[model samples]
Target: MIELPPTILQIILNFSIGLIVTVSLNIEVGFLNLPQFGRLLAVLSGAIVAAAVPGRILAASMGLPWDANYAYHLYNFGIVAKINNMLSENPGLSIGILVFTLVIVALIGGLIGYLSAYPALRLKEAYLGITLLAFGELLMNVAWNYDPLVGGTMGVWVVDPFRFVGAGGARFTFAALFIFFIAIAIYIYAELLARSPFGRTLKAVRDAEVAASVYGKDIVKIRTQTLIVGGSIAAIAGALWAFFTGSMKAATYTRLTWTFWPWAFMMLGGIGNNLGVLFGVFLYTVSRTAIILYKGTLSAVIPIDPEWLEYIMIGLVLVAVVLFRPQGIIPERPTLTLPEHKIEMISKKFNREEK
Candidate 1:
């Protein structure tokens, strides 16, 4: 039922957000071999902060009612509308809010990640994963119950930084383009990190913790660092999603949507491979969007309800990937630390010395 342009834009936006989150997951799970089942925690942190923080800052500065209860649904809509109105008039202020929200979200997400390191130090594998999952659920429950924190179960509205683009279709297009730009930036960062020395160290720790430790790598420190980076990045996705949707609900960031879906994307894209993950995200986003848009037609042929069709499709894809192509569509290739020419020169030198 949706029009083609809107559907295409929606797909791009979804793909961008998915890539950001999945790549963040890949950082911890793929590179460090950490079982990060609670990936939603960092994302929730970002969304809650985006929902709660920058809006309040803007509201207070503008002499709006930004009390502790500002996030309550009743007050939230009115205040955010005012904020958007103001932002629409001032492009610089709008951009400032976006930057400010990202910074705060990243810091909060990183803090949570650092705290998670405590458990990471003591627990291994499933235990660590369970602890992280519990952490995410705990935050969700708190946000849902704590009225001041994003209006509790009612959720809260977010400030539209892109309101400066005006109230038109162009706004959606600009937002989608900005989000895609961010996705590309994130992809570049992940690629560079994967090829960096720290990335190699992460691989070493992942492959053989004892060996890496013997080589003077601090296992605990490395994990803490990875979590900090991953958490910050994941939170950015959350904040961006809030901005794009123009609302935030604790209930929206579910384990199924944020955690498991990202895991599936990472697995399908080839875990530990940024480019592979990008491709995987694109494929998944397109397919998922198509199913959602055409669920009415699919419903007549399929026994399942249209509402649950996407879920079933995702589940089936996960299973098929696990059974047939465990390494994903694009399996992870060997990461080389040095340039080919440099390595060739070194090899020649070694050959001459041996002769």
Candidate 2:
């Protein structure tokens, strides 16, 4: 077996997280044609939940402080350290905390989605996008100011559910592998959802809302459902990110990283195509990682700041794709529900009848 380098492992981890979030965005913006400019809301929800909930639960169980003060940096660090110690010794408990956190994140994320549906019904296109974006920013600000929520500006340490795995490279590899596994599962789910009847309905609604309405499709219901599904999935990505990083800060979940980047990834990968999104995410993640790794070298050659190079490169790529390859590197293909032979036979019969 070949040993993977740390850089490669980091790429895998980043790719996995990006894939999960971008696929969730695709389900909404690509398939449903919803302008999801506030993808960060659900992601922040997940990260905040993952950061705030599980450790508190463990603390409470152990007769430690689990109240608002638990999130304070002074208490949070110690509490999380104790929790990590417990988690390291009990693999089963660690797994349970992981599952429990994800479940909570999904529920809260879905609720947020459902709540957004009211505004979604009223706002159209750009207005809706702006509303969603504002909502995410609002949440971020609240979390930042509210000391109880992930320690506000202080941040909080996340309970490491993967603590059972040995420390150093071994632990990082395990976490990366677990995240990759989840990414694959989400991809399969996205693909299946895309092929299902509901998926067809989403595309129909997206392409022609009036025609879909004429066909008796309830546009309101579909939009709500899509938001809930997408929100839940995005929340899972956020939770996984928190777990992988072993820390969480409300300020860390920014629009650029959680919302816009995913949008760029989805656009780069053929919109409405899960496989394309996967490829797009992997390509972008690796490229971004390489740029960061070689920032000093690039800075020596170019006058621009090293921090901005990645953004400039991605912006150029996005512009190039938009101007030249609007359909993306892998264009979206028609989903066929029937066998090729059957479709061909039906087509022939219809032609003969018309003749």
Candidate 3:
């Protein structure tokens, strides 16, 4: 039996994947200044890729026929792959097929993000939110009805990516490593963007697009660029999650809950600052997991609805954040400092441009 600590650790690891999804969204909303809502699209894309790749591998190993809907579904969803292929002349080709699936999904998702920016750039607040919400609903509907996409309501079995390491290695170890590396990369990227010149432009666009335009900035182009980058990052996070969980289901990708939850995380943590997003994830994860576990224990003795309690807790936290600390716990601060060489170079460039 797995010990309590290890079990909790595993849960933390799994939750971290969710965190990546939230962080990716925060970059768009908080940093890039887009009122977007498309977390499901990215997560689904990654999950499907992760599922398909490893599923084919396991099915071939087990001697089960490929093209078996069950096997295909499992592989595509990132569930455990356990079947054989009848159509293929070579069974070994499954591995290659899996890689292809991931690439295709990522590209498709990136395209959607790029295209959406046209409309996203024009709308503000409520209108933009509505448009994105509609897009998310449309995607979810497609996932649900399209059997080929995710296996319908039954969902598909997804082959675990770590399984590629073989049965001998502990699965949890691989999961931890994947999460750690990806999380670190995201952190680095977030900080880099937060401190970069482009990042400053995003803030200007965020605060006042009209003013920014008067300053010779193209609001549409900057926002479009922000959307593209944020969308791409989200896709990468989804792909990583797919590898971690080994499955993608339509139910997993909805906007009302999954998408909005990240917004809450950003607002609670401190919007406009990456560090606040990180802090929010840490706080939310702990409260959520720990409370659920405690509630489970308490329910056996007294009687409490777990889901309702969580909802109530989340709502209260959200209200508190909005009422008191809208800027977020950490809040955005001024940290503008240019090095001597860069300052001189900028001064020379400005003088030359003027001349």
Per residue, candidate 3 scores C-alpha lDDT tens digits across 1-355 of: 2223555665667556656666678778887667776666665656655554445555556654445464344444333422322212333454455455556656656776777787786787789878877777787687677676557665666544445433333555655665766676777887788789888888887788789899999877877777766666666666666555555676777675567787888888888888888888788878777777788685676576877778777888899999998999889886475767998999999999999
Residue-pair clashes per candidate? 0, 0, 21
lDDT of 2 at 107: 94
Q: Per-prediction TM-score, please?
A: 0.95, 0.95, 0.80
Candidate 1 lDDT over residue span 1-355, tens digit each: 1223888899889999999999999999999999999999999999988888889999999898888768878878989998899999999988888988899899998998899999999999899989999999999999988988789888899889988877767788888888899989988999999999999899989989999999999988999999999999999999999999998889888998899999999998898889889999999998888788888788778878866877777888899999999999999888886889999999999999999
Model 1 TM-score on a 0 to 1 scale: 0.95
- Please give the TM-score that candidate 3 achieves against the real structure: 0.80
Query: What C-alpha RMSD separates each model from the true structure?
Result: 2.4, 2.5, 5.5
Looking at candidate 1, what is the lDDT of residue 278? 93
TM-score of candidate 2 relative to the true fold: 0.95
Residue 32 lDDT (model 1): 95
Clashing pairs in 1: none
Q: Predictions ranked by lDDT, top down?
A: 2, 1, 3
Runs off by more than 4 Å, candidate 1: 1-4, 349-355
